[model samples]
Target chain A: MGGHELSVQPDAKLGLHKNWFNKLTSAWASGLGAVTHKELADHLGGKRLLILLGLVAVTGLSAVYVAASTIRESAMEAVETGFVFLLLFSTSGGSLPSFLSFLGFLGPLLGLALGFDSVNGEQTRGTLSRILSQPIHRDSVINGKFLAALCAVSLALVALTLLISGLGIELIGIPPSSEEILRVVCFALLTIVYVAFWLSVSIMFSIVFRQAATSALAGMATWLFFTVFATLLAGLVADAVVPLPSEPTALELMRHQRIEMALSRLSPTTLYYEATSTLLSPHTRALGPISVEQLEGAIPGPLPLSQSLLLIWPDVAGLVAATLLCFAASYVLFMRQEIRAI
Target chain B: MNQGNVVIRTRDLVKRYGSFVAVDRLNLEIYEGETFGLLGPNGAGKTTTILMLLGLTEPSEGSVQVVGLDPTRDPLGVKKVVGYLPDRVGFYEDLTGKENLLYTAALNGIPRKQAEERVNELLERVGLAEVADRKAGGYSRGMLQRLGLADALVKKPRIVILDEPTLGIDPEGVRQMLQFITQLSKEERVTVLLASHLLHQVQQVCDRVGIFVRGKIVALGCVEELSSQLFKDEPYVLEVRAQPTTEELIRNLKGITGVDAVEQAGDTLLLHCMSDARGEVAKVIYQSGTSLLHLAVRGRSLDEIYRRYFLTAEEQTHRRAG
Candidate 1:
């Protein structure tokens, strides 16, 4: 309360209001809280959100059950060094895809749905003009919305991971090691970053397109392109750029594979998949195709946590850059947009 | 006729959307503690002008000083004291009335305890105490409008701007809204700028009215002053039902110095006088031995004045084009 007090001259007309610096900073800080609270509530309580949650939950629990039953039979080495619990959480078992795969596949839709209506919906509801009339800075609204959606995604991922870990312990009759827990936590964080990138992209579209439905369509289209078509496109480009004969040298084959991998990594989905796989499965030492000559004399074991983190550091950085780029574009656009409706 | 201190002043303010000028070089001054109505038809740029004044939209040219603060440079400074209720007032349909106001208070950086107290006070003031806890979506149109008013005044702003406040309200709701607006201006002593396309909507509420047409203020003054300015030279009509409506009476009435024309119909005599010559006309009628049965002054309504102003403006444009 004391922080809220200002030495504003009661009778003063115009200029900066009393405690101008305090007001500006507080507008930024509290604007975050105000918008985040409302948006988080909307995301958590929304009917569509419930449907998405149920879909993820049903698919995730089934994957976990299958992975847990298999691990129960081979609990000895699985629980000691390797990240078996984390593997159960991230890997597909039998025919069902793992929880992480489910997130990778559907997480963008959740992010898109949360943010596609972030700006234009306010305009349609007639609240954009009203909210902007307040003492807060214009950019704070977009900032708050992005942060809130990110927070919602983080919470959902955390809850799901904890549920999977708890169920794994109950079904396998063994608790995970400290390193395994740390790796799972990192995996969860990386997933949040990946989803947040999509959220930022959706919010940018929301700002650019005044119609919520159109922005939503654009977000889904982008997600589908990255997840489903990016690999095909990357393969086609690789073939054209680095065509290799059927009996090409091993080095030439490796060069062609490198080119294709680089092209595929342009999509955020590829980056997220590579990063999460390394973090969730300690045995996953490399993301690209490796020749036997390179691994002939190498000792085969799970890499240390630091080595694993180093392996995927670039992917994590790429996800972070993409998120910031989308958010920054939206911020500049929102600032330049005229507040008045034509 | 200038009375109160000037609280808001705009000089040659212009807003252009590409080549289409939304507001064209408009100058306006609003006084403190006065309900200034911005009267216009649809697409008259009333909303655009208000947005510029609020600093929500930047002006292409000229400047605006609200409460002596340049809104363009110090929008937060202007916004801290000015309250605006857009034509379509929207609220979070999911939240209760109290929660919505509290959210706005937090956005304005009010302390939590004080915000709660203020939200309660505003909810009570707007006559929404009983339904304060209910979701706004459940509220009626009139209730939502009332909530919108409370939301605007939640911070106890020194100036209030309402656009079409009673546009979709029922007749009873319209009356209540007008009463509330009048009270807001008079009792609170807050400067009010109310924009409406309906002439009578502002007729009783605004102390001064600015008639906006086609991105410009075509006529601006106190309603009475504007009426006089528009119809100053037009003869005042006096309707009199007299006992003897004869040619002699008409001739006598016509002979009065200021009387421009006198017409007789049945038992009534219509006197078109250049000035208010009721006394002289009465004397002439008395001298003619005609007993005056009833005498009434005929004046034009604000609606008629609004129409004529537009008509004259149109003629001027036509003349210029030709």
Candidate 2:
């Protein structure tokens, strides 16, 4: 802020932020916040930040639609709330929403969308070499950019989540109690991981493709191929190619298992969302509708949230590790690539 | 400040692109408090050499040390003391000139107060104070060069390396740049390294020069010393009033001898003599029968010396082949 020539401006044109009074006023206006103000400025300076806000708007709109349409409570008030939860689990909480849909699914896509143009845009504008030539460490640029993008996607999620809460209050005519708010926060935390999952994926693509457009395309295509129609197509392909034997054998089971594993487990979205549902829901161990047969069989009670979390902790750790590994790989690649001005 | 010690030292520095050697084995040392010029024509490896020195490109062989730090192992260390302007300075087009300077200064660890004062001084010195807050995208080439020069000066680095600083500048801009460079070298005592194609480009301001050809330095020394040494008892061109035979030349001599070659124009005889013999040869011509109608002696220019002495090795190969 200091090295820019202030004499060029007639002293009046400089931003208020630099003025002492403005600093006091800015501090007053902002009051006190947990996040540093300087960090907030950097978070907003990201290139694709506006587009990411748009993504959040889409997420909020989708949440509003699902919240509005799925409230058919008056028809079956006796069991409608459970029906609603079941409907939410089956629709908004499942593979389509987590895989191809916006809330859980677009979380990772938004991460990739945040960083696909990181290095190449700088190279195109011819700042890469000059930036590297400075005294700053090479690690800072990549790390700073990723942190900025993460902040942006996180902000987007917060706004969307808040908007969803606001809409639910208006439409359902009830604000959630403190406990439900806490549950929402947990969901939001899970969504951040989901965002980080894709952010890492996008960042890895950014490092590989030195051109911005190519990197962006690679990111989008990877997201699409992994999340959309991957499992469904895998089953069809396996059925088409692997002929049914007279009797089911280990070979047939192995072929089907291989196909399902490759298509369903390969994507980060699928893995993370599956883990999220397992960890969040308390009634998952119960049958679809507990009937007399379940009572005869003596099914155990629903597990505690802690035990549920413990059961899926390995899966969560695996997915989180995969996200971080992708990010680390990108860091190494970008650090090694020549930062030429051209 | 090791008064006469070298600020930059490279040992047989070589940069290659697979089989093609962009810069061959080049060994050079630039001393402290001196304005050094790397003079070369196109495809002459000047850019490649600078890139290698700045650690922007890896060298195929040899080593580079700037201010006692290896550029490859200690690039941040080297960059801390060196301010470089690339051949075509490509700045962030979106940022204002002031923002760019501040960002760079902050990155270099300059405090806000000092960076501001230095930026003001640098902008005024480079004659770009008026457009400091304007976006650099719309700047003219000369203005951009001036801004780039100011940006480099923001750090007030000990070593300033400018590649083709005046390449696209007009005559006035070139004059301003050269004068600024000269002032910085003399007043600030900064080590200046100017890389350019035109030999005459920085001749007026430069203290010494390295003439590069085919990735090797054909010549390296102070301009004055090199000029004096090359022309020392070497050769000179003298024009006389009329063509003369051996008898007239000997008789018209004023205690002068050892004129090696003589040629005739329509009405003048050109005398090629030692650098030291100019006074005597002119006196001899005036005193004798030549009548001293027209006595003119032209010293060789550095441009001529570069063109005549440092022909690219490829040209020699071509000549031999032909």
Candidate 3:
């Protein structure tokens, strides 16, 4: 008895939209699904551990936050301030392993962190070579890992967001408007993109480093630099790059411009916060008046929301572009690196 | 077992790492339904060759074709048909053995229902049926090897490449491993390429063995044939008790018809003579009245054969040095 044969075209290496395509796609889905389930199961601890743990964590966090907020003003402030705190923590933990919340940079750190060691982990585990032994494309492993990582990140972040939101509605006395709901969804997705950036970085690291811990740490380092240290350095660079006069009047204006520009380039969080302010708060503007109208009630000038969005487009594009470039670099390296390495 | 001739053929295949030639220029062929043993020492390029065959690495020079397809150029196609097991099989230690098998089955596009059934059968076959639900991290080395065997066979691949499969296995595990491999070949009749440093194990299981030395294959043939060529020529041995009369009689009889040489081996006197002159050699010993203890034919175990070849290579180096 000779072995089984899958009907494959000699030339079409990638998937096609044929019956074979369906089989291959389903195969990929099942494989990735199993991987996702496995990770989720490991995380929660059993058959439906993901849901079980997710709900438990959700109920616990929500109940605790609601209970705590009622007792302390600081706890109430932590709801929105928690994002900033998380941002700060992630920036700190982004480059190294941590016990709690992963240095607040879990979002962007995840993109690379989730996958940097993806292929190598599988390779060392012997599954990568074994999986390749099947009739699937080497490309499928890459895609499947990326997708599985994506799924893992999505599930985790959504659980976090929903748990928080469920608490916000029940005890915080604010049902998010439909528009706010949309924004929350976008925020969730943005968190995924942030994580994906790290996931890609992690995947590349995985290709470069055979050890999973090394890849994860490297990705965390990248996240740390990008979110925290990069901002600090960019601030210094922005000041150095732009010249200011010593004269008092010109120095003041130059200082103001320098600080604004530096702040703009320093962190994606600052940029995201700026953008979110414009989107969430109707009165905020990109430029113009910083002072109130006089007692005479003379008209005061201020920039519009559209101008604010426009003013921040470059920063938005820069972060998104860097994220994309990192992912692309990882993809190329993984595609090229020989699967056999000691 | 050769159903359709050679399924894989390689000529002058060489792989180098920096200045070291991990795999020297070599030629080889693997036929269908035959378990070909690529036997070698550590760092002898057995794994490198297997990696190239599976398209995990690109060859520096030479050509390799598997199932009439270039492995590098047609890796995806070849991968779809072949199954591989590396030395360190790191599965999702967190995932159950059954889940690991199921994931592999899914990767091969095996239907869910069919896949589960196969997983159950494989789990039972590998003696992990009782603990199929346990996480792989907790598995013993033997259990993992068995699970790996299950993973490889889940797809029922036509070509199976197992690198150091029996390494780190206990005696019972080794028996079971060999038996499972034999079963695959016997039942599924799949072609297997077993690569290892275990020469004796290869000799016991493989029909043909290729002895790889310093990246190149120095010898290739049926095990029996190689053994016959190396050991059959020097088969006769003369033995005598520790006695002055025996020694003198041995020396005196040396010039007799067909005795090649006489030497002392511990308490015994060894006489090398033609196989046809065994009677004459014994008769000469009898006439000396020196009681002969034992006259035994020197038989070569696979270990002895391997040692002889390795020693010959070493001796050539010493000869050159001198």
Candidate 4:
């Protein structure tokens, strides 16, 4: 007994020498690493990710295939424009909207699926209490799970985009310009941010609702409101707020369009669409209503890549801010929650 | 028992959920290397108190210190040396038992090589070595519990808190688990705080038991001390079995001065006495020409102690109400 006590004494004393900050940082780092590694492995190996990836891939490939053939039909014209690669993502072929539009519509589902059960599922499985009982900070669980899921989403998005680009190159026989490649990269990043915002929202719902099914339903409901109804709601709101006459003045017309744009931007889907459109089509110089006088001296040709990025900076910032806001909300709620065995 | 170092102490610790008091002004001290039982029934606030001690839930008042560190102020420091097995211990169903333990090992910051060795050792100790490679989803209830035990010990903690370790296991499994816990505390010299509503099961393992009722500890001490203190009026119970027993034998046994009551239960004579009267009762049976087959004194079981205490408390409340 005495020998056992002596052996354990050193470990107790070792914890006392370190300052609180150092102890906290080390615990947080170790915990974050463990949780992220485990969750990432689970995500990559699980059937859930495979199903979601399959859904997104099939739709994205079909859209890109149609766009590639359409771009091929006008191959000579597209080649002269130096942005045939960008057209692969933006051009609407037949009944299918562009590949970018397909992503804009489907990305939120991927985010929601990944995060809707993150916190609540742990509670249901009775692991939350066990995990929180560890020496790690409580916030590490949420942060690590979020980081892992984001990495999975990013990996999937990047791979899917690369695959489409490769196929487009084969179909059109036009290797992308450096600027076009840069634009595509920026477009992918913007999509990731938009998806991250939805991910955070779903994670927040997971923390708020105790049942995983309930949280998933809440997440899908929010997704439906934003993706399918937000645009129509914005149109109604704009019509009600700024009703246009048959021969409306230019200011009135601009006001109606501006109101509709602002209201629709409230949805992350709209922000993603606007940003991706600007990134993929450099000719998009203005997002909101612009006067004829403001465009009087502007050239009709495609703007530089820098100008396109500058035009879409606010949209990207909005997406990032929304993501951060949702993440902050979930963090606060999760940290404050009482971790009792349910 | 009090000579050992104080490993876990709480002063005026209270927890409340709005108007409901979960743990009320709890003051406790547990010594190092002792198996302490927090015995209580459902809704007695055992789980709440355990949570506060682990710093998973904040107390509404007062403080708790585990291994010389405040759990709320430095939970990492406290948790570093303390392992916990929650009430309904869960594991990732998809992951194998070894994988689950490894995850816990990683969470405790154990290196891969060291963690692997430690995990294997624990699995072997918990007797889950044979099924360590199987997915936990298919593990039996007893197996999952053993896995949970391995998970808790992954950190090699100095202190271990097990909340209802044998809540829903077969009788054989419960006995084995309790025996394992007793052997663990003895071998490792680890301070153990076991919370359970099953008094008899707790009696088998714990060195000291605290009877928690309605968010307060009604009694605390070793079983012998508590029994002696509560049953001072009749400190001993002796059971005598004899052949060719007659009415005169019972009458003579009752004549012993310290014997309180004598009742014939089947073939045995149960005597509630103020002293150990096994010798006197045996002599009386022999004197009456009744062959004394067996004579033994029965220790007070926790069930009787708990029932007697609860009855007295209820009577006191009833008297006050009246």
Docking class for model 3 is medium
lDDT of 4 by residue, A27-142 (tens): 56669889999999999999888898899899998898999999889888887776889999999999998889889888999999999999999888888888988888787899
* Backbone Cα, N, C clashes tallied per candidate: 0, 1, 31, 0
Each candidate: RMSD: 5.5, 9.9, 7.3, 5.8
Q: Which parts of model 2 have CA positions greater than 4 angstroms off?
A: A1-47, A72-100, A177-179, A240-258, A276-282, A285-304, A311-315, A339-342, B1-3, B55-61, B224-299, B309-312, B315-322
Give all TM-scores, in the order shown.
Answer: 0.89, 0.78, 0.77, 0.92
**Tens digit of per-residue lDDT, candidate 4, span B150-226:** 88889988999999999889998898899889988999898899999899988989999999887888899999988
Q: Clashing residue pairs, candidate 1?
A: none
lDDT of 3 by residue, B1-322 (tens): 4545798899899988779788889799989889888888888788889888877788999999998889889886787778888787767877789998888877766788999999999899988999999989899999999889888888878888898999898999998999988888878888989998897788777877888877788777887777778866574655545344454676776877777887876776667777646567567768776665665555456776777776775687589879
Q: Write the per-residue lDDT of candidate 2 for residues A31-109, one digit (tens) a residue.
A: 1111123224545774556776676566556655564455544426513333233223223421224211456556656
Model 1, stretches more than 4 Å misplaced?
A1-25, A28-30, A73-81, A243-252, B237-271, B277-299, B318-322
* Deviation from native of the Cα of residue A33 in model 1, angstroms: 2.9
For residues A97-134, write the lDDT of model 3, one tens digit per residue. Answer: 32123213435544454455567777677666666666
Question: A141 in model 1: Cα distance from truth in Å?
Answer: 1.2
Which order, best to worst by DockQ? 4, 1, 3, 2
Query: For residues A164-240, could you state the per-residue lDDT of candidate 1 as single tens digits?
Result: 78887888766788998898889888888888999999999999998999999999899999999999999998889
